[model samples]
Target: MPQANVDFSLKETAPNIGGGRVSGSEKLTSSFDLVEQMHFFYVRVVRVRDLPRTRNPFVEVNIGNYKGTTKYFKMDHDPEWNQVFAFAKERIQAVTVEVTVRSKETINDEVVGKLAFDIADVPTRVPPDSPLAPQWYSLEDESGRKGGRGELMLAMWMGTQADEVFPDAWHSDAATVSGESIANTRSKVYISPRLWYLRVNIIQAQDLVPISRNRNPQVYVQAMLGNMVLRSRFSPDKNINPTWNEDLMFLVAEPFDDPLILSVVDKLGNNKEHSLGMCTIHLSKVEKRLLPIPVCANWYNLEKVAQDNQNNMEVKFASRLHLRVCLDGGYHVLDESIYYSSDFRATSKLLWPPTIGVLELGILNATGLLPMKSKDGRGTTDAYCVAKYGPKWVRTRTIVDSFAPKWNEQYTWEVYDPYTVITIGVFDNCHLQEGSDAGGSKDPRIGKVRIRLSTLNADRIYTHSYPLIVLQPNGVKKMGEIQLAVRFTCSSTWNLFQSYTHPLFPQMHYLLPLSVYQVESLRHQATQTLSLRLSRAEPPLRREVVEYMLDVGSNIWSLRRGRANLERLLATCNLLVEAWKWFDHICKWKNPISTMVVHFVYMIFVLFPNLILPLVFLMCIVYGASQYRKRPRHPAHMDTKLSLIDSAHSDELDEEFDTFPTSKNGEVLKKRYDRLRSIAGRMMTIIGDLATQAERLNSMLSWRDPRATPMFLAFCILASIGFYFIPWRLFALGVGFFAMRHPKFRISIPSLPQNFFRRLPARTESMI
Candidate 1:
């Protein structure tokens, strides 16, 4: 036999940070620690074979405080996992990495075999170099002595981020997620199924047979598609042939297999209904409409119900119902609200538009955050951020026990439309158990921010600190502020503009539009699918985080939101009201010279009708030029009033945060119900007021008022005769000159038309 050759490598001495002298062993240990900090050490558990009669065999890796287990294989002598586990060298406290094979079929998870590799024995490999080839090692006992008749094949190496499996490898950073949630920490791809809009336009029904002719049978069409059922308003004719020009829509996905069922029912007293006829329409055979053109209505023969008894069988009459059904592909099926929706791709792949730009968001850090939960009587927070855009979502690593955490992570997405928005929400991570000081199970929201891509200028970066305000039951609380840097870079200006010219949704939508509720329901499905997919990624974002960030409960009943929306409407109306006031002031001739000048300008425009549009456009240009200095100097931020957080009632705020299905006691619910009725009363009054105004205009011809209808008809007939002979310019001149007449000539009382319309009878006075 050849003589055994022994080789030794030189050990370099690592100088102490204090420049003090150290022993040889100390120097060697310091050198290893220094090396560990700069590199990553990992093992690829590849395969195992030749097991000697073991049941439910599995492999578990042990490294210091960390333990990872592979999936178990039953009734098999050989198993392949091909999993990778990476350790941050600086965090590893052990000198050796152990790989143990066990039989889980036993209650104690019986140890079948084991292998140990000293940390120093692990080889160093970098990318550009071939992957470390795995070799078979004999199974041994804890004493390093061969005991089991099996072999394991795996590779051990040190590498950087450039490693082939680096992105997918299980890392120590995410080990705190717990072994049970391992699947949520891996990378995955989820594809959403293409969906379309199914529209069922219920037209008039012919040859209808009523159950009772004396009752003037009230008829309505009830359509059932899947679990959803919608009923059209009762027909007004109430005859054998009822006309109902109503349309019912639904959201349907591809591979259309469901059938649409239509039932013609007659409403009777005592909460009873009688079916006149029924028909079934197959979605696969429905027409496909892409454009806004009208769909051709076809009459389908409705089958009458046949009742069979033990003694006799009775056959009912047949009827025909006019209907128009089609699958609309022209519209984009919204699975989320447009305000913060990331995905805008058409329901059908064929109708998907082209990309326009790239959106990059940098999650820098947060500051001045209040502690979310208490630990050992002291408040603390573990904060993280989740950003979603289009089909891609990114979650930053949690910064534990921090008040001001810095993430500084950047993510990018391909933008298809500038009008789309990206949502970023900061949340407290209360689920982490390892080294967790703050104790809480629910991840409370810090705040959320939404930025529309269209608002961002191309190639310009917007960096701002957005305030996070959370509305609690007691009041609105200032959570903290997050700093973010966002940039939207357009690839080509031409392409961006081209996207605007294209249809907002696919052409199929216009041909067969879906109802608002259908779109909302489908949006929930899309979000569920997205949540399932995103949970599979490395360091998965929890479902609560996803729901909170996406604002799945935003539509929940909120008195605060109602107030905010009402304020918005008032603000919009205020502008027009203010404009009217200004006009009234001018007409009052408060400034005689200005009013006279207005009258002159108005007369000129009336006399020269061709110059009217030019003068109006010129005024607009002048107004825009004058307001240039008052333009916004900075980007808009969240407003307490706009969000309705400031001055919100405690009860309203409580209801906003109330759990779905209501977890409150009966007494609390009763109080809430009373408050809700009060608020609804105001809304009802406003609605009634608006309806009265609209009805007054209709009553001029409706003959609801004994005197108003005939007077209005006589006035219209005389006006028509005058308009037929008089030129349009003459009419304009007469109206303008008369309205702009001097204050001395004007009357202080209300106009005759206003008084006449207000006095007209309205349906409101008859209501109880």
Candidate 2:
């Protein structure tokens, strides 16, 4: 095997190559430390020459990555080693070589280096042949029965030299040989129904020398598994192939994006089949197999075979065994054996006034062999026969093979109420009659209905079949619920939804009731309410029937359109859609021009009167201001202290001013009003900054509440009223203007009389 040739075993003791006295051990160790710190290292080989004359001569080199994997470099055993040395030097950097061989031991005058590769350097694609390569066989694939369409794949490595081919199974360290080898490399021919696939690894190299007595040179090669594979059917606990004595060895390849496909075909028809939703040809060894789908059965019929004697005697008899097998694969002359058994008897007036006839059958076996069941061999076989014989003795016969007379047996049977049987029929809903609307709208009930069964004799009891009644509202609807009534025969002990079918269902001697009842409603409301009722044959009123009436609740009924629980679901959906469309129209519509004009006129009428007076006064002032004469400027008082005292005692002072206490004898009160005004102005500036900072933070957390819009309008009205009271204060108006984009502070008197303070400046500076 190529794996053995490329021995991946780690060898740490490497010889130094310099053709001189070994020295500088400390320096070498220091260099290794530096390389380790760098987290990278490289190996350079000088050459490999002078090998035996084998089919392929290869030298294995090791540079650890995953554990220590070795790669083979093949070269010829040529005397002239110059070309080989050149090849090896080109591939590797000599300065940073981690492993080197300086001088070789002389064997009969031929100097072979400690490491075979360093003996000589050569550059060539084809390496010398090695003895191991010729003895190994290439794993290949061949087709079995079908037109030789087969493929084969093997995981191995690349070698430098020809004879350096990887080892075969015998030379491999991980070849398990207890089980049979795959017949062909192609999966189709190597079908192993008893085993499941593990993994497949395509590596660069695989080689191993026998290292222990217990471990063979060739060990088993099982597939590699990641987490997903380990969780599958072949877990470690059930890994049959990998025993403790065997270990799968390989050059574990790098993971790939795509998955591998394994296919196999079983030649022997001995495999058991299971119709678990599909006709699966079970294989224990192979993981999976894609089926070659055959043409489906279209025109088919149940057929009972009649046997003719090998001799000249003529006989007329129906075979005991009857099968409903499809003839899609074409008619087959079955040479295999057939098994069957039946019991027949007559009953008296036990079936009531009708005096019904009953024929019971006790089939022991119908197929050629026993049913392939579970590992424990529980009740895997189905009860294939039943009937109501009306309390009478019935004769029965058993047969191993219908074709062979020696395989027959006989037995006696009696009628019973609770027995089991298997029956099959094709479902045809087209011919069924619509059930009568017997159940009222409020009661949980089923309409009078009967399932039409064909080919069943009147005397035979139809037990297992269940009758189902379904009612759907008529026409296009958005919301509605469906009422279903499923009644089963009293003999049926369980419903079909459950896993186990009650054995008594098939033993009923007469027609049985339906097995299930259901009321399926939509979750959404309807878009339209239609009064047009369903036909008389249809059950429009049946809405309460359910599989289990007590289990359903009104909470599940929905107002949402198109929901399952909504009564008249389709209608409800349509109605909701209409409402949404009406709202959408209101949103998209533009008001008429006449209406808009009326609104505008009304608004002007309501507001124009209040605005007229202010507008008229403003206009008069603007017009009259051009004709007014300018007032003469007043001079400042130089003797302000004497002037103030005399002015304070002036007779112009009102008696109301006398009420204020004087600062001294008959003196005017010394008030700090001017200082207070100055301080108040400074405080206004600080307040403005604080307001600005608060406003900034408020803006940061500004969230609009739709419900607060009305309150905000009311606040604006209050602010407007407050501002109206301060006629001459512009700052007051600014404070009231809460919706202003940016605020500025200025003091101005809009209504102040000019003569009131003629000496004072008209507008004060801003506090900012």
Candidate 3:
């Protein structure tokens, strides 16, 4: 019966991955048992589509390995609604096809259909040997001839099978042509479907055991040569090293024993002109051995033992001695020991003081204020005057002298006087008048008129000038103008004052007329007008003034003192600078490379002066204290030798008087001495002086006290011993020490306890 054709759909479904539904027209079994042979076959999705709308679904298909595991498919077909069914059969064997139908209407939902096929291994047969097949002979020497050779060749007809098998044969004219025999032969050739034109020298006398005797040697050789061709997959290029050669095979070698030498090339594709000498390996020994050796063994001395074990061997053979290869510029050897040993330390002596020291300095600026000035200048005052005057006129004839005399005796006119007074606090126009005189005459006028009465120097009040004019105009018509002169003088002491108020101060405007006013009647006549003008005196001005002078001596002294202080501060900073440098230099040696003895000697010699400075200061302190204790009560110059003699006699007499019986005068002195001795004896006083001197000496030598010496020496000695014992470990410790040199970790020693029993016994007494 004809079979029913079952349809299959290929599907894929996974999170974030595109899913597809591909339907095949029918389920088809593979023509070969591809699973047994582990060969794959291919298939394609025939059509992929879904729903009523126009949008089409994505389709995917893959060929399966003969083991049923699939390899991803190449995209070969994409159409709006359908995919073509076209893929090779060998790549798609034993297919499991799943179909997925997806749409926006069911975005979260999925439907799947699956189909699988069992593939069978294809049947194959070996061809029968032909009577007409050609024979082959492996090459060998004949009759022991030096240049003897042989050759072999074979040919076969082709087949139309999917995989065709090649022929195998074993024929040799070398040695005995037996399995046990070995020979060196030439002129050999091998040909196969997978390999061609291969050659090998059969030179070793020993026969090579076949890896599998059951397997055909020619087939094995063909597969082996075919793999060689397959693995040589890269393209040949002039730029690549180990330049590809179809006829050549290169051997790999050990990096340490047979290191590949390299040549540098320039941009022009040529070898560099100058020879860069090759390095011959000369490895120093592994430093680990130095760890186990007693630290007492001088590192400088035992280095030869280390060198012997370095595992360095001179290279003897290399397949390709030198090859030109290009390397990226960024390539660098990262081994620190190799780089540091070669580029740095091995080439130079060990530099001492591995650590660095830092110093801090502070700068300050200072200045002063402005200077003061001195005193010198001043001035004096002004003057004033006042006047009053009147004008008149008359006519008389000499013929009527008697009648005129009688008229003169009877004629009297009241005279009104106008005087100008220069007053303070009044405007100039206030004391002014302009009109005719009392006689009503207009012929003569006076611009300025003053009457000189008596000089009132003491009162400072002169009379006003009331001028009297004689009217004698007769003989010559007597019509000439008459003139009058007026004068006055004043003394300031008794000057009359008027209390005139300023216009702005109306409350104080009342006038106080002078009591000493003396009037003088001086005359001028026929005045056109009596005009008076007033003027006020200006007030005195007030001022403040001064002068200055420099005291050069005081300035010089101040300047000198300031300069001296500045120089002293500068000197102090300079001392600190030098000390800082020296101390910093020493502290840097915390990681010194030299031995402890070297450091000890350095500390003793280089630091001795500084250490001794403290000692000298201490000695000076002791000396000062002792001198203070021995301070003289009076001037040291007084009494001189006499005082010393007197002191000696006093001490002796005081001592002797204590023990001996005395006469009346001596007894009285002894009784008084006993009372004085109770206060303080001469012997006790001497002993106290001696004790103080001893104390001073003892205190000054306190640095050498037994306990202090051990502790101080131990610190220095241990630091020194660190240099000898643990070089690397000590280096690490020194790193910490250097870090500690910062303020946060400065080496500050705690205060030491003082010895209350201040003196050391003599060596003899201690021994006894």
Q: Please write out the lDDT profile of model 1 over residues 1-768, one tens digit for every residue.
A: 111231111112232211243322222112111111235688899988887788888888889998777888878768898988878776789999999999988889988889988998888896678989998989986667784659999999987544667646776756656654444344332334466767788889998888876768798999887666788999998788899888776777656666899999998879999999998888888988766677898999887866676646565657999998887666776766644466667655566677787887767678788999987799988787878776567776566677887555556788987656687888887666653323435678988777656545566555567767665667766677787766677788878754544554444544445565666676675556456555554565656777776667655566666665555546535657888988898989898988889899989977776555545544544544454455332234556655556557777767666676566779778677656655664574455466556655644554444234445555565554565566767878999999899989965344556545545444332111
- Model 2 Cα lDDT, one tens digit per residue, 223-284: 22221211111112212112122212111111222232211111122553211010111122
How much lDDT does each candidate structure score? 0.67, 0.21, 0.21
Question: Cα lDDT for residue 211, model 2?
Answer: 28
Per-residue error for 136 in candidate 3, Å, reads 99
TM-score (C-alpha, index-matched) for candidate 3: 0.11
lDDT of 2: 0.21
TM-score of 1: 0.63
Worst 10-residue lDDT window for candidate 1 reads 1-10
- Model 3, span 1-768: residue lDDT tens: 111231111111111101111111111122211111211122223332222231223322322422111111233122232222122234344334322222222454222222222333322222243322322322223233322122212222221111222101111111112221111111111110110011111111112122244532211110122112212222222221223222222121111122222221112214322211121211121111101121121111000111235687443221121211111111111111110010111111121112111111000100111111111232110011111111111111111101011100001111111111111000011111122123332222111111111111111211121111111111001111111111122222112111001111111111211121100000010010011001011110100000000001111112112333333334434646896876666677754654454577567746553343334444444554455444321101111111122123333434433332323366678677555544443333333334434433442333322222223334344554544445544576887888667777642322122222222111110000
Local error of candidate 2 at 426, Å?
47
Using TM-score, give the best candidate's number: 1
What TM-score should be assigned to candidate 2? 0.12
Worst 10 residues of 3 by lDDT: 542-551
